[model samples]
Target: MKRQLVEELKSRMKLLQEREKSHTAELSHLEHKVKVLTEEASNRRALVDSLKRRLAVASREKSQQEAACLGLRQDLEKKSQRVEALQARVSASERSQSQLEQTATRQLEGLAQQSSLALDALQGRLTQQSSLALDALQGRLGLATKQLEQLTSFTKALASEVLVEVQEVRSELCRKRKRKRLEEVGDVGLKKSSVSRAQAVAASILNMTPTDLLHMLDTPPDTEEASTEDSRRDQEWLEQVMAILQQQIPAAGRLMEAVRVKMKERKVLTEELAALTAPVSEKA
Candidate 1:
């Protein structure tokens, strides 16, 4: 019975030792697990702290972006107000410019109408004056032509009378020479008579005294040339008068023509103005 108890006790001791060893191994494993858990927890805590810092930075950036956006909005509002003011000023200036242009155009049209009316009146006066002057000049020219014709006829008649007298005297002198040469007649009466019968006969035909006939015979035959020179001088004077009249007439005509041309231009300008304003008038 004692051996049996000793064997039982040894078995019990062995079991107890085996159980202790198992308990010790289990405790070591649990320690290793605890260490792993602690390291993981520390890593998790660090990641959370980093996330907090990131969040803070993100919030600050968001606040700064918001501030910038507010400033941009304020600047945009100010710029919009300034743009509105500029637009109002432009509208006002445009209105004033339109008013000024309208007034100026009206004034120009008034002046143009006045000038055209004045030119028309002046043209009428000039036309009447030119016509009267032309009539007067024509009458004067007719009178001068009649006088010139009378003077020419008188000169021709006087020249012919002088030529006839000279020819008769020359023929009588030739006849006296022939009588003296052929008849051998010598008479003191023939020599003493310086005024011949031819002179008396010519004087009678010319209705003048012998003394006047002798005087005319003494004058050079170039009397006709002198009379022609006088006539030529009268003609030159008339030509000069005609030249002056021509110049004056042309000047007056040119003035009238210029006035007419101006009137035509004014008419054309009025037509053009009407053409230009037609659409506006229709719209109005």
Candidate 2:
């Protein structure tokens, strides 16, 4: 009975030792599981902090973009207003330019019309004056021709009378020269008489008026005795010469007056032509 009891006790001790070993192994496995769970929780917490930082950065960026959009919109509105103002100013300038051009054109046309009328009037006056001047010249020329013919006839008559008187005097002088020696009655007396007659005739012609010469020519030759026939013929010839000289004076004066009037008209025409051309040059 003692041996059996000892065997049973040993068996029971061995069974208790096996149970303790199994419990120790189970405890070690549970501790390893706890360490792995703690490490996974720490990694999850770091991931959540990184996600929060990324979200905050995205919100700040969104706000900045909105502020930039508002400023761009304000700039666009200001630019549009400036464009409209400039367009209005341009339209006003174009209208004013058009009005000024129209006004200038009308004024130029009016000036042209006035100048044309003035030129036409001046041309008509010039033509009328020229015709009247030409008629006056023709009348004066006819009168001069008639006067010249009368002078020619008077000269011829005077020449014939002088010839007749000179022949008579020469015959008387020849007869006296035959009777008396030429040296005894020196040529001094002959010279003195000839000089006296010539001087007296010249003086009479120079002193006579135009009317006196004409009257003398119209009247018949004076009948003189043999002693005074030579003197009377000389006086008649001088009167004819004096009448011719007086008639020419008035003709020369008329011609000079006509030339002066023509010069005045030419000057006026030149001034008018310059006035007409001045505007044309300025426009060019």
Candidate 3:
């Protein structure tokens, strides 16, 4: 019985040894599986981190684009405002130009009328001068006729004086001849002194020539009076001409002054219109 008991113990020991070897193999396989699972988990975490980085970059780009769009919109608003202001200015300038053109046209028409009136006045003055000249010519012709009549009267007076002197000289010569003949025939006693006196009287009568008497008749009776009459007529004519010239000079001066004043007013108006129409600033 002691030998049988020893053989059973040896069998049990061998079975126990086999079971321990199998358990060691199973534990090694389980440890290998756990290491593979840990490697997979690390890979999934890396993928998640890469996705988050991509999302951050995309959000930043979108924000920048939105800011740029807002700035562009603001610039457009400012430009629109400037354009509106320019349009208002343009409309106002057009209206001013129309009014200025109308006013200039009216002023030009008025100036033309004034020029025509001034020309008519000058024509009237010229007509008056022409009439006065005609009257003066007629008066000169009448004065010439009166001077001719005075000359005729003087000529008749001179002819009468010449005839009387010739008659007296002829009578003296006839007396002298008769006395000489008596002396030569010895019909009467003729004194030498009386004969000499009669010859002297005859010679004196012959010396009295017609030209001297005519020169004496031609001398004017009132030389100073005639000169004074001529001076008075000349003064009167000069005074009339001076009066006409003085009146015309003042009229012409006034006309020029009016033209200058009108021109100055037009210039000021034009300057004001230009300033009002000019742009305040450049358009965008």
Candidate 4:
């Protein structure tokens, strides 16, 4: 019995030793799993710290961008106000320029009116001067015509008086002839004195003595001393000279008529000159 008990105790001791070794191996495997888990948790914590630093930098950049946008808006508003002020100044300058142009136009119109008035007045004065000159010339022409008529009448009367004087001389010569035999010795003296009084009268009237007046109204010759053919011939010659002088009166009348014709032509020219000037004077 002792031997069997001893063998059973030995077998139980061997089995317990085998169990102890298997349990020790399972404990070493659990320790290796805990080390791998610890390393994984430490790597996750490092990645989260890097993500937080990147988020802080992004927030600061966003705030700076917002401040730049506000400054740009304020600058735009100031530029708009300056533009409005410039537009108002331009409107005021345009109004002043318009008023200056209107004033200049009015002054120019007044100056033109004054110049026109001065020109009209000058024309009127020129027309008046022309009219006055024409009237004075007409009056002078009328006076000349009247003088010419008076001279013509005086010449005709003088011609008649010369004829009467010649007839008286002839009659006186006939009477002296009839009384020759009845009178005494004064005949030669009378013949010498025949032209003396007539020459003096002719010098006074004609400013020169004329042969035609030599036989007119001499003192009667003593008929007995002066009766001769030479005396008769001399008396006939004087009568012929008187007749020639009478003929000259007609020639002087013809000269006067020709002068009148020239005066009429001059008058017609003056009238034509006046006609040419009439319209200008009236317009003025």
Candidate 5:
């Protein structure tokens, strides 16, 4: 029985040693699995950190993009306001130009009317003065014709009947009277007919208006030089006024052209801005 007991104890000790070895092997396997799990977790954590970094960079870029977009938007708004102001200025300038044109037209019309009326009055006065002088000349011519007829009759009678000295004295007296009458008639005749007759003849010969000849007669040594010079001066003044008006018109046109160029530039800027922001807007 003691031998049997010792044999059983030996077998149990061998079994216990085998169980201990198995438990040690199982524990080593479990530790290897834990190490593998730790390594995988560390790798996953590193990957997550990398992804977070990427996300942070993307977010920062997005923020910068948003800021840039905001600046662009502000610039666009400013440009839009500027464009509107320019448009308003253009409209105001156009209106002012229109008003100025209307005012100038009215002034020109008024000047023309005044000139016409003044010219008509001057023409009427000249006509009346010419008629009066012509009538006086005609009367003198009639009296001279009568005196010539009487002298001729008296000379014929005296040649036949009077003494030589007496007839010479009578003839000298007749000659003196004739000279005085001629001087009176000649002076009046030249004054009345010189300008009109010369102008009429010149107009007929040159195929021009008598009024143009009349204006030509307005120079030095002509009958109406003083009045014509005044008229010429008036015409020059009117021309200067017209020139001033025309100059102002061109200035307004130039202003309008400048505005048009500015508008074109604004349109170009707007198109470029739209192009620049198109992608941003699409992303938004």
Candidate 6:
């Protein structure tokens, strides 16, 4: 019985030892699982922190882009207003240009008509004045011819009288010299007197004045008849010249009136031309 009891105790001791060994192995496996779970939790926490940082950066970028877009929209609105104002101003300018063109055209047509009328009036006046001038010139030529003929007749009569007087004086001088009969009379005094007398007669026949005759002859003539007739005839000729000049006065007045009218028409035409050309010149 004592031996059987001792063997039972030994068996119990061996079973307890086996149970302890199995429990130790299960605990080591559980410890390894726990270490693996802790490492997984640490890696997941690092990933979550990285994802939160990315979300914050994305939100900031989105806010900045929205601000920039708002500023761009404001600038576009300002530019659109400026463009609208410029368009309105261009339309107003076009309307004003059209109105001005219409006014200029109407004024130009009226000026053209007035200029034509003025030119026609000027032409008619010029024609009348030209005819009057021609008639006046013809009348003056006829009068000059008549005066020239009268002067020729007067000169011939004076020449004939001068020749007769010169011949008589020469005969008297020859007689006086023959009576003296000294070979040649030292009558250089008488000869000089005769030469002076002949020179004076020649000057009178040439229709020179007394003062002019004295310069030509260097002495006085023996006769006074030629000088007296010359003065009387010159006075009569002057009166006839005055009468002819008076007769031309009315024709000169008519010519002056025609010139004045033409000048007035020209002034009117110049003013009309300035008015007509002003608009076109401004555009140029």
TM-score of each: 0.33, 0.26, 0.24, 0.24, 0.30, 0.29
Instruction: Give a tens-digit lDDT track for model 1, residues 1-284.
Output: 99999999999999999999999999999999999999999999999999999999999999999999999999999999999999999999999999999999999999999999999999999999999999999999999878766754564454345434434544444344344332232243454344377678899999999877865665457755855774565455444433433452335454344335434534654555555456446756
Candidate 2 overall Cα lDDT vs. reference?
A: 0.64
Error of 4 at 196 (Å): 38
RMSD vs true structure, all candidates: 33.2, 34.2, 38.3, 40.2, 39.6, 31.2
Q: Which ranges of candidate 6 are over 4 A from the true structure? A: 1-22, 90-284
lDDT of 2 by residue, 1-284 (tens): 98998999888888877877787777777777777777777777787878788778878887888788888888889988988998898899889989988998999899999999999999999999999999999999999899887965675465455445454544444344332332333444767466446556765878975445534433335422533764564555455444544564435444344434434534554555555446547756
Candidate 4 lDDT score relative to the true structure: 0.60
Question: Distance (Å) between predicted and true CA of 81, model 6?
Answer: 3.0
Query: For residues 246-283, could you state the per-residue lDDT of candidate 4 as single tens digits?
Result: 56243655545544543454465455555544654675
lDDT of 3 by residue, 14-120 (tens): 78778777777777777777777777777777777777887788788888888988888998999899999999999999999999999999999999999999999
For model 1, the local distance difference test gives: 0.68
Clashing pairs in 5: none
lDDT to native, each model: 0.68, 0.64, 0.61, 0.60, 0.67, 0.64
TM-score of predicted structure 3: 0.24
Check candidate 4 and list the clashing pairs: 180-223, 187-222
Residue 249, model 4: lDDT of: 45
Candidate 6, residue 280: Cα displacement in angstroms equals 95
Q: Give candidate 1 regions above 4 Å deviation.
A: 97-284
Q: Model 6 over residues 99-218: C-alpha lDDT tens digits? A: 989998999999999999999999999999999999999999899878866754564444344434443443444333333432233344557567557657877789876557644333
Name the weakest run of 10 consecutive residues (lDDT summed) in model 4: 177-186
Candidate 6 CA-lDDT value? 0.64
Q: How many clashing residue pairs appear in each of the predictions shown? A: 0, 0, 0, 2, 0, 0
